[model samples]
Target: MNGTDTRSELEDYLRRVRVALADLPADELAEVMEDVEPNVLEAFEETGSIEELTKRLGTPEAYAEELRTAGGYPPAPSAPTRTVGDRFSARYVVWVTGFSIVVGFFTGTVGGGRYASDRYVVLMLCAPILALALWLLFSGRVRRVDIESLREYQAARRTGRSAVAQLPPNVVEYLRSMQPAWWLVRVVLLGVAFIAALSVSSEAFLLIGLLIAGLVWAGFRVRQDRRVLPVVLVANAFAVGMAVALLSAVISDADSSRSPYVTADYRGSGLWFDGEPLDNIYAVDAQGRQISKFYLYDGTGRPLVSRGDSCEPSGSDLTNEYPKPEVDYTQGGCTTSTNMPVLPLPPTAPVSVSPSTSVSPSTSVPSSAPETAPGSTPPAPTTTG
Candidate 1:
């Protein structure tokens, strides 16, 4: 036979032997396979034919049975017959566990702020389902082997490993190096989510605290036990969800707080004084004379028009005209007045001014005129002729 045929026959023999020993504990079976494989390879290489190898070593199953007997191991236990309910229960546990974990983590992370109660309700509801799943796992009704044996699970595992294997070695190592940092990053994300929720509701403190603790524990456990990897992955997903939720909430708040008049379609018309809207303007000249009508203009000479208060029949319109008509809602009915509601005071009394006695340019006061006494009126100035 060709070398390829011989190698294939050898591999087939080893595969059958492994199947025969499958009931052994994993470590013990591995030890038995290690001892048996080299001897089989040596015998095959020497014999040069499968028929001769089988005559010397017996069939693969008989060989495995001889090894079990020589090792003082008991006979393999018979496979248990699983009922339909058993299959259903295992599948139910798997599905419920996954669903509860994902939904619970999402609700717990996003339930902060105004919807704190919603988080509690969802968690409470999921708790029983999750507890049942855990019980099934611990009770061995749904074994790890059962889950791993599933076609979907095996396919996913193969796909993941294949994808990772396709990466360059250096890139894979770089990603491995980042794994430790991700644990801390997820914790920080949880903290950010907590603070964001706390800004709107104080009730998120306990929920976020528990999540942070779980993340820390999961990180630690995963380092020691690779079986905890699924837990770590779920925690990472939760952190990503938290970050997305926080970003969306922040954007929503910003949009809400923005002024409605800040949009492209906004056209501001009313006048404002010290942040307060002005419905109308009143103008008066320095002499307190009421200026009946006047237009306003800005520094650039743009008409500073505003919608003035309009009486019922007169619709509101933009105008720069000042002293708009006043509308009064009295007990009788609405009344409109174009006249100034507040009358300007009559012009102040004019100061009387007697004309100063004419002083001729030729006339001059004597420089040596005597100073006047305190209370006495100065004697009529004597003519200094």
Candidate 2:
């Protein structure tokens, strides 16, 4: 038998011994102490002296053990009890750790290199809302049915297992099924699951949050209450920030016009040859590329309008406005519109300048003049002055 379970014979003998030696109390007590003390000192097996023996007896606990052994008694039993608060705190720690991991992973993934990615915004904005909804649904109404509310439940008494199970399904499951084997599997699954869900949504945190909310909702119905509001709330918060970033990106992305907001012509001003058009004049080659070719009434075939460097737009010297339809009188050029005047010279009329005279002729002529223009009569010719 264990020493703690004292035999009835030993107890009876000790009591009879005590009663039989009743005459001299001090001597009796001394005799009992002497007999038992040596036995205690011998148990350790190396007692040099009383001082050594007393030193070996560390404290009251050791002394009590010695007393219990000498008295032939069983050791007093300990209380087998745990408080509710300690259990609740342990569960809270696990839940918070798991939830933070999920939230942080999604926030980074969905934000991508830039949260401007449209899909990321969608996911980040919505995830939180989904979490809150799941909490409300699973927690069962705004007011929780705490044990305090129950008629039979009392702070004075221990609460029943059924009452604890009445907590959110997630809480119940954690308390009930949180075995080491299951926890190992869950931590791995959840770690990967958080990543997979975030990745699967293409880092679209809002969408992933929405998807998680659905999962949370369904889980609550199926009694998976550990799927709490906090995780879902984390996911949803990511969704919201992403959405705001996206909106800001869109708003801030002002589309500046690539084409000049206000366009003016090239002014087409430059030097020309015999076949070249005058400054600011329009001339099309067979392919319709504007050629500077134009016929000038002057002896030298310079561009007719705005011929020299002195040539400038008739109006605003700044030249900021749309090119005004100037007659191009300085050099003589046509406007872009077809309805504008045609300045073609006939071949028959030749420009004659007196080589002796410095002045050149003013007008041009057609090379072959007899052909009729569509609706016009031929102009009368003037004799030289």
Using TM-score as the measure, the top candidate is 1
Candidate 1's TM-score reads 0.47
Residue 350, model 1: lDDT of 44
Q: For residues 255-374, could you state the per-residue lDDT of candidate 1 as single tens digits?
A: 976855453212255554434545556755545566789876653456656555566565567676777677778746776555666766543444333233121111113222122333
Assess each prediction's global lDDT (C-alpha) against the native.
0.62, 0.39
Off by over 4 Å in 2: 1-227, 255-385
- Residue 290 of model 1: what lDDT? 69
Worst 10 residues of 2 by lDDT: 355-364
The residue ranges of model 1 lying beyond 4 angstroms of the native Cα positions read 1-86, 151-177, 194-205, 223-234, 250-270, 273-275, 278-385
